[model samples]
Target: MNPPSLSFRARARLSRSAGALLLATAGLASLAGCANYAGIRSDKQPLDVARIDTAQSLPTQGGQWPTMNWAADFGDTQLSSLIAEALANNPSIAEARARLDRAAAYAAGADARRYPRVDGHYSVKRELYSGNALYPEPYGGSWYTENNASLSASYELDLWGKNSAGLAQAISEQRASAAEEQESRLALATSVAQQYNALAREYALFDVAQAEARERQALGQISAARFSAGLDTQVETRVSDTQIATSNTLVSQLQGSITVMRYQLGALLGKGPDRGLAIARPQMQPLPVSALPDNVPANLLSRRPDIVAARWRIDAATQGVTIGKADFYPDINLSAAAGFDAFGFGHFLQFGSRQIQVGPAIDLPIFDAGALRARLKDRYATFDTAVATYNDTLVRALTEVATQIAQIRSIEQQQHDAQAAYDAAAKAYQLAVIRYQGGLSTQLQVLDADRALLQQRQTLVTLASQRRDQQIGLIKALGGGFDSAPPPRRDALDAMTSPT
Candidate 1:
């Protein structure tokens, strides 16, 4: 037997052979399960958001652009109050705010993974074991209880940037959500202001309708006097009656409109119809007239909340693509565990019962029939959608601003023409009334002048309302009411502590 023993070098060679055999098996398994990339394509084109150019000057628009809190520029406390209420209680805004909270939580969860993770584990068990003397049908059995407790820790190597890419994507989404919340606030505030403007407009029209009714009554009284004295024709009397009826109808219709608008304002304030009924006519304020700079700043696009949110979404999608590609590489994780275990309770804490384990694990994604490639394709598609969305948002935002500038210009010219017409007609009506009272002009002539005056005054009212509407429209289109959000921690923390 001693003569047949092999040398140490021969044993070393045999061990090397066994290792080679294991490696060969691994290679064969990889080949057998490998994925094909024949139809899969990698789209690596550089991404960009479209830049829509716009001319910056309009004849009728003047005064520098309205500053933030533009509703205050109108100097209507009621309007400011409505906007504040909407921002606080609008359901849509609350939903968006909730979304921001969810995104912030996701961001924190993702970031937490950058460091190591530790966990505690414990277990208790009772087992029966056979002690074999002859190992017959019913061998002697003994019962024993075991207790174990352990602490385990693990961390990822992040060798190929997979974890970092995931973290980046999550953070980008959080920022995007914050921007979306800003957009929501801006939209709600603008909506409240527009509704308030509508209420003001209705009140102005109601006043004009009442004035027309008064003029109609005066004319009707003169007609009745002439008819009773047999100095007026029946046709003239009928015409006066018809005109009076028409004026009353207009006045009633205007009152109805005013009622409806007040209700609408109440709803925008997150209140009920009764709240609107308590409101009075808006104190007239100077029309909002603002001019933008000729050269739109490069950062102007970035300032728009929607555009900013869209860009962040694109960034998040890009990181998603990175994460998908990273899946093709091997992932390495290091783990460790230390604990105590014993068959009996008394010795559970003894040195001989101690246990510890430490090691590294490697996962190779060498198989799966095109699953990884398919996932990568899906990610690329998401990225494409994000880019398209961003482009569309940018173009729309720029268009809104440009169209508003032109609209304000045209409305200003109309206001000028209407004021001139009102002045001329008013003078004519005053002179005609004086002449008739002095018995120097016919009743029919005085009535004609008064009707003309009413028409011109109504035209002025309509123009003023139109200017107010356009002014608010332009301000909203320019995103003039909101600023950047407060720091994320303050907002996110508040959301976390908010009641369910």
Candidate 2:
């Protein structure tokens, strides 16, 4: 016998059950066809500060990180002002700032993806119907106008954390850009200070050259008098004239170098060469001796802008890997639309012309010739590269600090020895001049003493310049007074991918 006819309520219940069964079967089939991403992962890891050997080069006590106004310690107000100007107007600084803004904009865009997207659309068209096939009677061969207006909305379920991971990645990149901007500022400021120090060295050498020239002119006069009294030959006067000419040439070279240095300083200040001309002679005090701060490599991660930027990039790459993994799962979206459609304007707003749709859309990643696997592999590789770069930056930063410290120490000793030598040479030149006047020594002896004194003076000036330069180098290596909190730990990053 045929089954009994079902009541309306029973038929409705039966229909609901069938729909649920169909949806469940489809979900299982989708899961069975999903692409596998089991073993593809990044193996690279960041370097541990404790594992790297510091070799006792960096002192772990009695030191502090450089202050923001570390340049003031050099007692040069002009240098500080120039650094400030460069930070404000340098093209590199501007570029970095623009990049930061771009990254922030990208981050904002990514954030917007987490919320529902709504769009409004309207269109009108006039068309002629064919007299064959689907059209019939009066409708056939008739011209009609169509109107459509829709308001549609969609929201991703984010069950697999794809949207969240993407937002996190964008935020990390924004932070990295911020750190890089600071890095640019530090580089520009240090450059200005180093160039200014070089300019001061040149000026000091110029003064010595001018004094030597005056002494050579006096000696030339003495040689001419001796030759006229038959005490010396024309050879002596000619040698004295050559020495005076050499001194004048040195003075001229120093003057030219000073001008070039000023031009360079002007460029660093983001101005024309004329701007550098306005810079006054630097009245720098003695270079202050500084020791390395405590914690050595451990604190360097936060102290160095480059290192901080690298770390942030690694965080961004980590999020990229999360996003890649998320792609292997299903993407479900809830979408709804309400609209009006009509053949003519008379019926466009009528209730009978209203249309509505609401449903969940699912996108399953099935077989695609290994495209998904390849994408995941690329993300893993990118993560590995970011980790490697961070490691390299850390090692390089530590090496720079150690190298500058060694140089500074060596320069200090050299400066001490050079000062003593300069004092002795000065006394010897004085004695040689008195002896020559008393006819106890030859003109050649005074000339030799004068050459020794000039050589010593030049050495002293060069060492002083080197000391100042290395001091600046050490400051830069120590992160140029950059200070910031450390990036989020690994656990924090993992928390981002966890479901709410």
Candidate 3:
């Protein structure tokens, strides 16, 4: 085969085309600033997921994760109903729903640019003519009418993919909005659970306080009797009375705390604070210790709704950078109008009343005092911000899971050891009473043992309350266990064929 070379004219034309190509390439390459921003999809932990504790990841799914009623762990029907009601009616959820709609509408509007737009306009006008104007000599200052009817249409050529970029940004934002709504719902549900757990703890503490007060009074009475019988000194009675006063104060304080917790719980239920007083106290149902999923770090990044929303925002920002760069080129649009127009009424609908006009409009970025460049810079910075925020969110989530897991583990041990201490104190109180009755121990000694037993019992109650709260905390850290709704079907074909 023979080798062929370009002639003189072809070579010159080719050089111009190559120059234009280089200019366009340079413009787009400026937008490659997108490469500087970190991606949200990479599972590699930021600062090692902030050194997350591996012991308490969320539970692994054997099947699809359940429609997790996390509050059910407490075995309380009232609590369950409260959670369900809050999800159905909370104001925050309503606001999130409205935001989702707004974002979807914005996305739909952006999609409109993918097609042509047509509009119909009609107008009738009557105006008085000046005597010196045309036909004024024949009919002085007479009124004349004009009529116009037209169909005007316009479509963008999308030479730079600007319209598509806008649509992509909008869709990414809409996905982010949906994720935000999920997060809000999860937060509301977890808030109700936390308050409900708090109410339970307060009630348990109240019971312990009441029992301790009762035991303290009994000891005070024993101390009084011993002092009168010359079996104990005035110092013993003073110590007993002081102990009783302290116990009484604690009982009052616990009563106040319980009332406050009830008020807060009622408010969370969207009821009056007075309603809090009317609600029944939760029973001492045992909360089971839960196991974290083996893939704690990765599971949190993939499953947490907040994390998902953050990732979506990063995508939106990336598309925004593209949109900003696209503005550096010319915008091309095609418009057409066809219509009937006339000065005379009868002839307005007849023959040459019809007219048509069509053309293309082009807008080139000639000069802007560096405005476009500044805007592009801002878009890149915004993308950087989104990436930083996403990494920070992952870090905090890991820290929270670790902190909650550590607390739960520590509280469980405290619970076991406190129960044993209470048991030992109870036996000691019994032996002291027996010895005092046989005159082997003083009445003061018996009173002291009784006081010690009450303290240990209170300590055990405190541990129980802590365990319950931490268990709820652990569940919340795991994203409230809401099943992930499937990602919206992309329908690439349908999306292409029907932008609207």
Which is the better candidate, 2 or 3, if ranked by TM-score?
2
Whole-model Cα lDDT per candidate?
0.71, 0.86, 0.72
Say what the RMSD of model 1 is. Answer: 9.2
Candidate with maximal lDDT: 2
Give per-residue CA lDDT, model 2, range 1-500, as digits (tens).
11234569866876786576459546844684468677675556788778999958776866778878989989989888989998988999999999999999999999999999998888999999888959996988999999998888999888778899999999999999999998999899999999999999999999999999999999999888888888889999999999999999999999999999999999999999999999999988776676778887888889899999999998998888788878877777778777888999999887778776566667777888899889978887878788899999999999999999999999999999999999999999999988887778999899999999999999998999899999999999999889888787675234333322
User: Where does candidate 2 stray beyond 4 Å?
Assistant: 1-34, 228-230, 491-500
Expressed as tens digits, the lDDT of each residue in 119-171 for candidate 3 is 88889998787888666454657877889888889998787788898999899
Ten consecutive residues with minimal summed lDDT in candidate 1? Answer: 488-497
Prediction 2 global C-alpha lDDT: 0.86
* Global lDDT of model 3: 0.72
For model 1 the TM-score comes to 0.82
In what order do the candidates fall by lDDT, top score first? 2, 3, 1
TM-score of every candidate relative to the true structure? 0.82, 0.91, 0.80
Model 1 misplaced stretches (Cα beyond 4 Å):
1-51, 56-65, 128-140, 428-452, 481-500
Number of the candidate with higher TM-score, 1 or 3? 1
**lDDT comparison, 2 vs 3, better candidate:** 2
